[model samples]
Target: MSHSPAPRRRIPAPRPADGFMLLLEAARDLRTVGAVAPSGKALARALTEPVRAQAGQPLDILEAGAGTGAVTRTLIPQLAPGSRLDVAEANPRFAHRLSELVRAHPHLAGRPPEQVRVHDVHVERLETGRRYDVIVSGLPFTNFSPHHVEAIMDRYLELLRPGGTLTYFAYRGTGRARALLASPAQAHRHRAVERLLAAYRDRCATGRRTAWANLPPATVWQLRRPAYAVEHSGTRAATAEGAGGAGGVPGPAGVPRTGL
Candidate 1:
């Protein structure tokens, strides 16, 4: 007796990272519930490619304003073994949740406890004198003023390690209805974002190239000191000393000093 051929078996499809669009929905809802600005997941996704290209080996990432660790959640699994992570969040409640998430996940558990510091302090305050090999941020620069933008930029300049990279993004396109819904103060906020981007152009190691594939489209800024530059401390010292002296010529107008 011949047995009938077994019915064709269907292979299960692969699931997207964090359940795909559902993950995006959850991230969107988190921002909505908090009445915060748009989450930069699209930008964060766009950054992954560049980060992989630049980092080569496993990356030691410092993520600011991780929210529910949406971006962090996506990024950590992609990293290689022995890579470290340090996260700083301004919201205590969210920070606590992030801590819990790290504990709950196996991939995240590999990182050291000391690496994650969930403080309720702003980036500028938390980053002073601390340095990171790679910094990923989701802070809403569009909510800040021009001076506040400059202040944040100064912090980035100091806190990013030589040969390190920094990645952050903002939403640039909005419909008329969305614009009308935005507060009257948004115009100034927009200017703040523009100025911050201008600084990125002037300072970032990656220059002005942008990633066009993201949902809202975003610019990526990557900065790194040259190998020779990193090895030569004497030249940097001379510039530092000259800039510090009372008689030295001034830098660009409104560039701000370490404390200003």
Candidate 2:
């Protein structure tokens, strides 16, 4: 009997934490002189829950200012079998580290390099031809100037296809918007988010702030682009119905989470 040729050797899956050291090094080189980092656990929650709420639909996601893959790590497991994600980061060091992290994850193994795209450019500088179904951001909103904040907000809002969701979190304690306003640099960031959201309040399907139990007590802001005939209300409502009180506005629970 002829002996069969030796089987080809299979490569081991990548380690999820290989880039941990690199991520820390990159963090040290960021432009943020003293920005407070969001708690990893809270950041993870902010990334995962939105996918669950969307029922793990195969869709496009845009993440801004992804530092060291904290949020991406949490989001990967929550994605549908073939979901695609794009990260837009201003810090080159952090961006490079993020790219390395994806390559090291077991779930990300065997995928084409293009499966994960990273843009090492300012969020404001990105001009992607494609729109996204969801946009997750950890930008330093509380530290930007009003103009900068407005610009970023308007740009992202324009990028969102109708009915898309934009999820973000703001610090509440020492790093909170209210507290940050005491300093000029951080104050700009706070005002920008306020102005931008106020300008587009009516077009959101779910606009609520969640007070996190995590350290620094941050607040999470989540908004979804509205379908036809939907409008932004001035006040914060617990659910869509609350915002549309007496008029049968849809609630967050019933709104089908799908890409526009």
Candidate 3:
């Protein structure tokens, strides 16, 4: 008699020391690293919802501030063939970790190396000329100065193709905590950043969702770039590039070019 074959066990994504690394990074630089823990699976799902919604289409995706590859792991499995993902993490150590994740990601097996790349640079500084269909941001906007926050938001919108979506999350209760524990100056700065963000939300917000299962809970906001802006920006970028302006900055030494 022929014996029945057993099913293959699914191999889980590599997640060694993610939480510990996040905590250490946070302790070393809370302003940049932002969170004390890696983002939970629920939050990752919420952030990658746009990608899922656009399933089967080859897309250009950008992930800013990918910390410890929490969302990256969730994203890799969802990428359709011919889709490209560019991960920008300003933290060098985090960028290195993300590179490792991209290499070991089971879903990325047999794919070209150019399909996904980790850039050790700030999203605003990423000079890739390609615009994205979806942009997922894991940056801590609340911790930045108002000017910095505005710059990053501007960069995000510029990097998105017309009608493209950008998803980002902010932990719940942060405003209350800032008001209660922060000094007057810090609280004032936080309020300023909020107002700046509020203006953008008022203009471009497409949807909002809350991830309660995440550590400390979080709210994910989705914004779409106005289709009209693309034509104008494209003209300006072309002009700048034609004039040999600083529209594109060179990547740092030892950093691989994304070639997007």
- Top model by TM-score, which number? 3
Best by lDDT: 3
Q: For candidate 1, lDDT tens digit of each residue in 87-174? A: 7777665677666666655654546665445565777787434556677767656555445555676576556666666776655453
Say which prediction, candidate 1 or candidate 2, comes out ahead on TM-score. Answer: 2
Off by over 4 Å in 1: 1-42, 54-58, 109-111, 115-117, 127-130, 174-185, 205-219, 223-260
Consecutive 10-residue window with the lowest summed lDDT within model 2: 239-248
Please estimate how well model 2 matches the true structure, expressed as its whole-model Cα lDDT: 0.60
Models ranked on TM-score = 3, 2, 1
Clashes per candidate, residues 3 or more apart or on different chains: 1, 8, 0
In candidate 3, which residue ranges exceed 4 Å CA deviation?
1-16, 230-260
Per-candidate Cα lDDT values, in order, are: 0.54, 0.60, 0.81
lDDT of 1 at 186: 54
lDDT of 2 by residue, 1-260 (tens): 99999655342323354355444544674334224343456655864566778865787788887866667777765656567788897777678877777766666666666666888987778877877788888776644544455457656766777777888776665435456445543444444445444544444536555546555565676777655433323232221212212212223332322322
TM-score of candidate 3 on Cα atoms, chains taken together: 0.84
